[model samples]
Target: MKPRLAETPVLLGWAEAPLSPWSRFGDDEWLLDIRTAGRRADQNRISWAVELPEGAVISRTAWRGLHQAAKQFLWSMTTNPPTGRQRLSPSSVHNKSSALKTMIRWMALDGLETFSSIDAGAVERLRAWLLVRPGYKAKSITANTVVNYMIVLKDLYRQRAKLDDAPLADPLPHETTYEAAGLTPATRGSIPFIPDAIAISLLNTALQWVEEHGQTIVRAETIRREAWALGLTRGARRQCSYHARKALRRANLIGPAGEALLGAYAVRHAANHLVEACYIVIAGFVGMRVSEILSMETGAVDYHPIGETGVAQAYLVARLFKTVDQHGGRVERWIAPEPVVKAVELLEQLSASLREASGRRELFLVKNTQYGEIVPVTQMHIGWRVNDFARHVGVPMHEGKPWAFSSHQFRKTFARFIARRDRSQLFGLAEHFKHASVAMTARGYVGSDFDLRQLIDHESRAETATALDRILLSDRLAGRMGERIVVGNARFRGRAGEQVRRDYIEFVLTETDLRIHACDYGWCVFQAETSRCGGEEGPSEAGRSPSVCLSCANLVIEPRHAPYWRDRRDRNSDLLSRANTMTAAVLTEAIEQCDTVLNRVGEHDEQV
Candidate 1:
């Protein structure tokens, strides 16, 4: 066998060649070297690459070789990635570094020392080990997580193949086959939306609390301490004239201090409630992600003129972590409602103390009394506060457990509210959510609630009832003097008018073929299976004209529709009066059509 070199070659000059002028390490590049004792610069300080064996096996020479190769691969990807590929973000690089370390540790455990020994069987065995391996908190590893490990391995081997370094023919299995071995497919989980009732209650309580307390809460400690001091002094007073007078003063001070302390305590309690309330209102109403909400600056909210109109439109601008371009930055703009604007103002006031102390303008900082320092609010902090608020306000049980709200739920709820009000607004909602496509918005944001079906049925019934009322009580029909009027098998008499109306409504509701639709002149009782109207074929057909419904057999008129036909007749009369010989004929025909509709409803001779 050829003797292995004592040291591995350094592929990239990490210290000499700075990735950029603004790199964290300065011009003293000689301070960093690959073979430095104690802690190597690449392994410890500036780089994510770890020292590994050089050869394909577990010998000392192989460890050194692998470590140097891995470091070069990582450095290349970070600064000068292959064409058509961008440099990895810091987070991505960190993830890859961690995954590679885990894979090396797994290889050491399996007694596999060399790169050549890592065949498809070794990779498969590593996959099985990862599947049953205990992860954080001793939970079994997830399928998605296993997939990530496989991807890192595949990338490592592909890089080795490019350099003709490793002896393996196929280092990793096909990605599809590797991923399919996992328990579940890799996909984003469904987003949870808070129940509408719970959302409303939360907002209402929050808004009410904010209104009751102007801005910041005054701590009770100052006033309460004063009151306690006075109480102690009053107790220490002796029973004498001099002491009695002093006791009187102490007692007087105690009463006022006690009242002030109580008031302060109330304000303090209100302040605690307002913190969560403000967050909920802003998150739920504004539809901003938790990260964006936390990233807001002191002056993020602003108002500007909308187009040429002098009317000012309020909006908020915040940093967006997701959906960035090639550059690692994205900004999102949100149109703010009045409630969101007020909530933001309240947050600014609440965070003022923290902002002043830390010299940081982040809108959601909280002062840590223990450390006497202000820190940026985190997801865990928000979660704890939300749960605290929910407990305080007695948030009702959800599925036999107390409702545990999260910040993401607020965003999903906001999307659902927009979709419920007007489905067409979903496209606009997608823009607000910063989603790439409407389909993504629909799948993730739009969800049906338990009461959705009931609500739909209720609205349908209300519309049908309105249509039935309009057709039953036409003034035109009432004007016709007859004991009974007959149409087909149905009969309507003066005494039995109410009964006939009831029967018609029930029939319309029960029969699927019968439909009540509003036409240009009045309502049309179109029966799909029995109607002879030519308009059913197309709108341009002869019976599809506005005047066709006036003379059609399926026409229905009532008092509710009288005003509309009257307006048309009067307009036509005015047009006929001003018409020339050519226009007079058309005007006259329109006038006749209006007259026929009025006469059918018994309103032909009632008025102009």
Candidate 2:
């Protein structure tokens, strides 16, 4: 009898195929490629295929079909790529798998078997069930999470539709159907920038410790100092360090006197905590993602000339995983300021031994023990180191808890600082942050509550007050001039003048602080929207003429205005001298008005 062929599924075997030079494989050739891909994909499917939670069981028929679909999905996700389409990252694959598992579990619970049994009603029921169900963390399942599940189901159907032998009866609900299912949109919160004092306090505590124990054999102390310096100076802390320090401190390995005991007992283990602290500075100051910062290789920093300037600028070449294309490749040249360069250099020096032993080019690795077992610093480790530092330094409390420092917060704080310093350079900020547009930079980094209105109001009031004071102190106008002012049919003097002055002073002192501006013929108590003067509407163009302001009811004659009136009178007098009988009448009328203005100013001066 012939030897039994391995019972490997076509999709699983395909996923295991080596991805290379056969860029133009046809459908038949691709099927053959799957055969050549080997059994790793089969093994992977076996491992993750039917991982159900305790007490969860499905019908044998349902399991067979569901398992086949899942295997195909996982295999295709890894191996098959549509031309020009980017392959999913490992994290993306994991997330999709998790969603599928949840759906399968729901299918078992509902007693539904096979894709044909899943309809819109089944999906809706699943959504309702998820809404009431509690997550592993015991919190109510969120609508956003439900939306994700719906997306996975939709993708599962989409993949089935592409296959020659699909298992589904009808296509799943449209993408829009999932969207209209009442999922709450996610809201991004504002950036939280720590106060300078708090940052300084944390740094000072770390520095003080480092200074007190100069050049010690305790690896923890050395790592702690390096981490603290990085966090405080470069704003580079790892996500792991945020909460990692708490566990270390609880272990009596990361407190004020923990260093001494740590030195004697677990020096090697303590080294990890110190390494975490160093991450804080790099993340916080450099404003790079935790993944990018951690993935930095040895000698990532290099000096390059900045434009035509003789000064050499430091640049850090690092992989940017978040914004990578389909190929999972992202490289960015970040401008490294002095502090960042220094911090990176120090990190290199500290991790030198560990890097050599591990034969890894990554900048951040720690020795596990005396035997020199090396491991890459993880996000969890960084969290512990940061919290430990914060706790030791007595960082200010918020909501009865010490302020939790995380890598995300560090990036936000960095953005906030840059935006606060200069809002006009938002484009430059966008470039530095690698944001797609200035709008995103503004929305994410800049606060909406900037106080520009108050500043403008204050400046306007000051300018008005200065103009008013100049007119009040002029030689032409003297004491109590507001009382003597007169216009067309209105006269303001004595009690009226005193009232006007009183109103002016009160207005200036009040919160509104209304001010006078030069209007058509005279001054007007107009301040954008705060004008108090009332007058009949005049011709639009003439209404704002300086000549019209002269006869307005709001006009106030003073000694300072005498020269202005005199000039008008002299011009009118000259016109009157050579005027014909018809024009002489108009000239006389104009001269008389000028004389009247001059008389008001002279009389006001006499009263003083």
Candidate 3:
């Protein structure tokens, strides 16, 4: 450098008659120097300017350094799990890097090189300088430009240089913090409206209508025949495979009897609607996710009834369809319900006539139609049919947008229903849903924290009510035992007639409530003992048994007090105690049902 000036260098003023850089290079080629100072009447801040150059030039060394750091930082950002790719993608990198570039241009306008060259004091000064520059009032350019600049500057300083004297090491510095543009919170997009319950009914109606139409009638029937066969054949894969093999060996395409039945039923039937009905019931009522129901084989369901016709039961076993890891593979689970059994039974009845018609049971719905021969009823086919059915039903349709009705929602709904009915049975619900943890299922699918808390609180209250009721019942029985009353069937009574005086009477009442108190006390005790003592972890042992009362003491009365002791140890006391326990169990069951219903309501509200 030819004797660089030590004093603050003066820059050319716009008042000093400047020529437009755009004259020669045109607007695109003219480097838009967004950095300028004191052009506006307001306070001092960064300003914009256009710098003219001689020829086609490589980037300055400092510029290259900034670009390289940005590229490296970008690469670093992208190097994360694929699941998080959107948040840390190359596109995000580009946005961040672009901001950095603007910042670097500002730095250049301030006559600085390699942001690392600026110490703590210089950074302070540069920030002060930025406040007064013109074009700094532009919000996007000001905020993001400054933020990206500081970030890249800090990162550069951290990696390339170590300076204990850096001003950034201080608690705080006054500078504009620029963040990426999209980082700010904005209004969320409106949730898409899909015709819900009514829409589904309409879709079903439409499918029935489409089946009645001339063009698709035969194809519709063929699909129904196949779907029915699928529904009818319920066993393990091996069983299905064996049956399928046998059917293939027979190879009867449209048997005469089947054709005759089809002709007879043709006017009244719509096969597509029947197939649609099968899916809707399977995917909806059974709570199987769409993929699970679609990929389900004939062997997945066990159609055999556990009991009489109305008291039916069936079990379904299949691998869960959607998983994080495809290779992890095959999560085997089962669901059993009477309603599910009934639905499967109906489907089997419908497909009964077609079993003899197909020898090559490639899949339940494969047909040699005009469209093609032996088409598998895949997920795509199901999705298409559902959409078409929706359209036919006069429900407005979108091409690829997901409808509110999906296979997954059904599963969620099922879990919600079970949770609503029996909250204490969360573990059981977890098992039914084949979830790894009750907490996971609850948190993931359940509603707002307030609602969940209320549900749990309701459950707790119900349980408390039940326990209190039991204690009350037990107290009544103990009090009755003192009277020595006997009756037919409920005749038995326990001992301790004379011993049960005023104090002992109080003692019996106390003992019945004592067990309930003991549990509450033990829970409190264990929590306190472990936390206060800071000793061994995990569950504490049960406390000792409570004192016995007139209801439970089993004390014998002598003949001397025979008049008072008559029939004191009769069966009534034991019967009353049993009754008390049963009442508690029933009350507990009712509470559980209340909990389940509340939880289900919560889930429904969340979806809404």
Candidate 4:
């Protein structure tokens, strides 16, 4: 450790003058930029603020050791991490500090006063205690949670030379880190996706508030904020009651049916609900991390059109806080649909007055300021508002209580919603979630939410199972897979009679190496060996498109898909009418393929 005066401790970060990575900060609190600080920003709150633990929370000897270890650990992380290791992310530093604090408190419980007391087998004792530690869950804390506390204990030992009252020796000289905590490879937590009906109700109602009443709520809130700012609400007597009632005649806070939805221009309480609605619309649809959405400024939403595709996708531009593993705070954008765009636009209009007055442009701001300072609302505050919004709209109760709403649940729920209906889900969700595997879902949630892909994959397989069952049961199916399923059912008809197809489907699904990729165009009974699109590698994303499935031997065109093929044929014919020679040839071939399927299903004369 670098020698320093007692008055200028290392935890304050480089004392008076700043050093590399060590910013000018204090012992009590340190605020680091989310852009450069890696995962430091926990929520959409401003730059991450890691506060010092109070000394009285644990024994004085343990507190000194922790404070010393934290100072050296943070200094090493910020200035010089161990060789071959990059600096720890600010959030990582925050977590270690948090874990160590918990360690000291737990040590205090054991009547241990100092880190040096945790020598040799005492580490194992701590691990045993943690294994049975109570949490918010019914069972003892998962081994995964135990890992957080165990790693910090290792840190205190490894850096003993530079720390005061540090551990006497390494805690895990013989055991692996996970071994020390009993964290098995499979000991992980996976959050559940929201139920489908509730998800629909929540999103539809939220969007309704944004699209229908958003503008009025914003306008009305602006008026009220301005009025109160100008000290207009100081009357004790009902001096303006007569004039206020007359002014109510000009109020325009009416719903589509012209009902007084805002109650005579009252919008202060409405603004609270409107903010939560905006949160729901943006977070629910785009699946943005709470930090990213809350970090949005007034002009964050923009139109980004790819002229080549003729698709104008709305984008929410912001500093991505989770990119610190490669780079910190990357300026990126998520593909925001129309509803998301509208929600952000409404927030801009609603917060216009506050942004100008407070001079901070955070979209989610505390309505009332204390001591003339503006404050950004935290994620927990948003949760409370969402509960109120749910009650106001009569969202269904679960187990006799309103369903709990959370930031991650929004992303997970969005995943399942898209998984069921959107074939282009992977690309969109990857872009939105920041997940490299499925979509953009990972960027911020890499530490925990990457496992969410398991849930979506689960949803996909269930959907495929259902589609496969439907196709096998269809007597009038067409295409290669359709013909094969029909013939197989016929071959078993003599043995199983009317239930032959059902038995056949059950056998194939359970016994055979069958894979199905169902889409709006049709189903593709995919085989890696014969697949032209996937080409023996596995299921390629391109295999789901209509063009790729058209000529593939794996294609399965059920009778139900006749209307889709007919509509597609008509649209392509219209394009062919004005196409150049080369394009016209391609269109002609596509039309011929559609005609072949139409003939096979005897849909050439079907109304569709």
All candidates: CA RMSD in angstroms? 16.9, 19.7, 21.9, 9.7
Candidate 2 lDDT over residue span 60-110, tens digit each: 666656655564565555555344545654445556666776777787778
Backbone clash total for model 1 is 24
Please list the residue runs of candidate 1 whose C-alpha ends up more than 4 Å from where it truly belongs after superposition: 1-10, 14-71, 80-85, 114-117, 136-138, 161-172, 175-188, 195-204, 210-273, 325-328, 368-371, 403-406, 422-608
TM-score of 3: 0.30
Model 4 has a clash total of 15
Question: Candidate 4: global Cα-lDDT?
Answer: 0.64
What does candidate 1's lDDT look like per residue over 1-608, in tens digits?
A: 66333222333243344534344221312122221111112332344334543432355565544444445455556665656777765445555656656776676567665555677888788888888889867998776677777766655555553332443555545546345445443443354667755777776666654544433232222233344455557775332333333433443322111332134344345555677877776776566667667778788788878689687767787766544542324665666656567777777776666687789887777666787677777766787798898878776777788877877777766655543332232324344445443333433322222232333244345445666654454334421111122232234335567788778777767775444544334445554433445544112222354555444555555544556677887998988888899899988888776676566656634422
Per-residue alpha-carbon lDDT of candidate 4 for residues 1-608, written as tens digits (9 for 90 to 100): 86543324553444342322445422434544444311223521222232334444455655555555555555555565556766666556665666666676666566667777787677877887787778655678777778777777776676565455567877778977787777665655566666655777777788788878888777666555444444445653343433433443456456423455433245666777888889998888766677677778878977766678786656788666663354446666776766677888888877777787789887887754546655677766677788788888888877777787777788776656444444443324444333333322322222233444555555556666777667655566677667777776554444355476556566766797565665556777778767767645334553346777665778788877888777877888999999999999999988987787777766754422
Pick by TM-score: which candidate is best?
A: 4
> Which candidate do you rate higher for lDDT, 1 or 4?
4
lDDT of each: 0.55, 0.52, 0.37, 0.64
Q: Which TM-score value belongs to model 1?
A: 0.54
Candidate 2 segments whose C-alpha is farther than 4 A from its true place: 1-46, 49-57, 75-85, 132-136, 164-182, 186-273, 326-328, 367-372, 422-608
Candidate 4 residue runs with Cα over 4 Å from true position: 1-63, 111-120, 131-142, 157-170, 173-187, 222-246, 255-259, 262-266, 305-313, 325-328, 369-373, 399-401, 417-608
